[model samples]
Target chain A: MMLRNTSNAVYRVAYESVSKLSRKLNAAKNIDELSSVFDQYLKYLFNFNALRVHIVVGSDHYYFVFPLKDENETEFWENEVLNFEEGLLENGVPICQNLNAEQANSLIGDDVQNPVLWGWNFQYEDYCAVTSLIADENNQFSSKETEILGLVVDLFTLKYYELITKAQLVEKNKLLEEAVDIIKQKNNWINQIISDQQNVIDERTKQLRYQNEQLMQLSVLNAHQVREPLSRVMGLLDLISFVEGDEFEEEILPKMKESAKDLDEALQVVINKSIEEIVNVFDINSDKM
Target chain B: MNRGSNVLKVLLVDDQKITNFINLKVFEMVSVENQTIDYTDPEIAFRELDNHNPDIIFLDLMMPRLNGWEFLDRMKSQKIELPVVILSSSTSPEDFSRAEQYNNVLDYFTKPLQRDDIEKLLAKL
Candidate 1:
């Protein structure tokens, strides 16, 4: 009866030693941070020499050891199990046993006296975990401590699930932001292509309008300027037979020759204008291309 | 006039004076006894239309200041219904079709006017 009273008194003192739990847990970003949080608080919550926990979340197995050699150390691996963890996770039942000679020698050291080990397997909706706490005769873990161990395990495991879910949500949000950036870049590229095509179409329409005006000018030159002198030549040619000798020589022939020369000059002018028009149009087209 | 008391009075209008010379020569070759009044300036011809009192008129299509169509339009507005023969250098189908719309256009001929063509006109008169 005295041993129970002393154990209860020790637990009360440990609980009072712990200051803030939620503040520490809120600052935690990863499981490594949570590991430090648990390390600081676990000793105060329970009486144990060593604590080990193994949790399986998705395909990853998280294993941690308490009473860390360095407070700043943070390293966790997947699927790395110890010999003691195998027995702890062996069955659905709870274990409270005194370590045999060989087992005690391997876990602690051969020098340590009678060490007792306690293990429990916890089942949750998404995952399963196992935790073990070791004690010795100097620190007596009676049936009362065993009952308190259940409550402590429950609280730790619930906090661990919250931290894992928060981490996964952050990973998914980062991926979403990257996808939105790519879509914005693609939209800008499409707008640039559309504006470039519009500029090309406008330039082509301008060239076509200029060429059309040149063609109209050429047609008017062909109809009026070219045909005017040509008609005079035809008319004088027929007058050749109408007159007598000196009148034909001085009057008719000279007039016909002059009309023919006028026709030739008109044709030359038209030809020069056509060449100039063609060169100007070609220049307008090639400069852009 | 060879046919006495029925004198053929011809009015010739052309922008080119050289073209007018050729038409007048053709009229003389035809031996048609006619009193001819000719003008290189079409506006002069349009002003002297009632004074000339021509039985038949020869008109050129293309001209400076006043073209054949504009002269004809003015003549219609003045209500001068003289027989007119279009003597143009143009052989365009559109020009021929357009001349058909003028009420007093008796014939359309491309220049220079031949002796045979003058005979046909005198026969028509």
Candidate 2:
């Protein structure tokens, strides 16, 4: 009757411990948060002295050790654990255990009394996470206790995968935001260039209109000024034709010479004005540049 | 009238002496038996209007003392009835349009005047 009552109490404790651990694991948001939760509760839940979690994603191996009392012991355990993982990988097994007190003492050290090493190799897709639990002799794990520990480890592995996936999503969102900012800056730069070019084009168009007006004025001036002298020459020639032979030398010759000189002077004025306008236009263009 | 019975009395007013000389020679070439009087000063020409009693007056537009428009204004105030023709170096449309506004302005001619222009004036006279 006492044995039956003790067994009932143990079953109830195990059920409550697993339910609490499962709740904590589900609530974990990140790797750091999950690691903290495991560190705080694993000893109380399974009575283990040390806990080691090894997560492998691609070529990278992440080691998470708990209650690391001695640095030297941690280093030694890490080498041993790596060797054990390698052996498991070679054999293509998912779990390995060394529960003998004598073998555990010889392999690990005297610090642990009756150490029971439990290791698991978990794979989800291409990624693998291997975990090991070590118990001291004073709180040596029974088969029932180790089964509960296994359930805890399984929960931790699933939570870890969830945390890693969430971290990757956050990184991708940050990169996408940076890319959007760069594209906006480039568009603003291109708009500024287009506006500058439009200003130059507008200025050139205004200058061309002014030049056209000046050319039209010049043409009108030429028609009036040049025609005056030409008309005088034509009239003088008509007079020369009408006059008798001797009368031409005395009367028409002097007037003809004067009219020809006037025509030459008028032509010179037009040429000078045109050259001045051309030079002014060139100077205006050079200044713009 | 002083030169002959059928001869016309012609008055020529220009600021340039060379222009007056050319017009006088053109009149002689056309074989017009007329009494021609030339004046370089517009004021002198206005003063001689009564004495000459010219049948026709050829006037220049641009001058130092008095421009053609101002001369015409004076002529209008004085009630002068002589047939005046504009003989100018300017072919501006504004000048032509302004000349048309005067009642006594018989014609507008851009110099140097052709024989055809002189002949037309003579025919009108």
Candidate 3:
């Protein structure tokens, strides 16, 4: 009653297939991997020659049809389901229906015998599975074999939650790695800015020290050289008071004129030397910039 | 010149003939001429240091062939210890500080070497 195929002692083989399917589903890393596992194993769970399942979760839809003959692969898509599956989605319950020859031939093509269609609709939370199975007299399900159907429903729910939780965690981990990468880039940028500022400060201090030394040299030159002849002129002017008018005209007066000329020349020396030194300092600073 | 009868024998050494001539007039102003010998060339004056035998040497600092510091160094090397009064036209504090390093350098004066400077020299003498 629980497994209709037990008459052939095939329940052991079906049990092993369902156990392998559960292992494969749990071991699967992503939706694509889970889809491949389902394609390989889901048909072996029940007594059906042909199986068609349409599953909908929110806006995502998956449809898989396995017409197993000569090891044909499962055809899966967002495919349109059979007319009986539309009815089963609306009714939200199990259904046993006799599929006429035309309807049976339309799916597995005239290869079936006395084909009967069984429908199972299972819903949990926002998820729904609409499964329509066609089996002929060759591999028919007893109406009372709800135990195996119940086991399949439990596996679907468990597999769905496992893959969904993994998917959410993977999405969140990707965002976390992106955030960490942005923070590292910002830290490098901040360190670069700080180093640039330190270099600027060091350059400015060096230039100021050089300019200050140049200024001190120039000041010493001016004080000693420029002041020399000017003082000589003043000295000659003071000599006027002691000398007689005739003596002053011959001695102090001509000497005063000469010292004045010397003062003018000394002024030029200071001016030219200061300009040259200032220009040199400016050129050095310009080269650095 | 109230020089206390010791009639100070003075030598004036400067690179400028005009500066020496002006210093000659300072000696005239202080009424100490005939005791003063002036030389525009410091090297000539350094060579004639013994012959002139002056009680005081008014030495100009900046000159050709021998600068004041070198002149002082030459005098030191020759053991020519004389009372040297530096008569430079520099009012720099560094010059004032530098002059202190010479043991034979009696005083520093920025020109003109006026009658007051001569009086101070006489008093110090």
> What CAPRI-style quality would you assign to candidate 1?
acceptable
- Candidate 3 lDDT over A124-143, as tens digits, reads 67678777677789887776
Judge the docking of candidate 3 as incorrect, acceptable, medium or high: medium
- Full-model lDDT, candidate 1: 0.75
Model 1 chain A: which ten-residue window has the lowest total lDDT?
Answer: A70-79
Each model's DockQ score? 0.27, 0.22, 0.52
Ranking by lDDT: 3, 2, 1
Show model 3 residue runs off by greater than 4 Å: A1-14, A25-37, A53-58, A67-132, A142-223, A244-254, A270-289, B1-125
Structural similarity to truth (TM-score) of each candidate: 0.56, 0.56, 0.53
CA error at residue A90 for candidate 2, angstroms: 4.2
**Fnat by candidate, in order:** 0.26, 0.32, 0.79
Question: How would you encode candidate 2's per-residue C-alpha lDDT over A150-181 as one tens digit per residue?
Answer: 67777887788777777888888888889888
lDDT of 3 at A35: 64
lDDT of each: 0.75, 0.76, 0.76
B2-96 in candidate 3: lDDT tens per residue? 34346678899888887787787778767444488988888899989988778888988888999899999999898988889999887889889
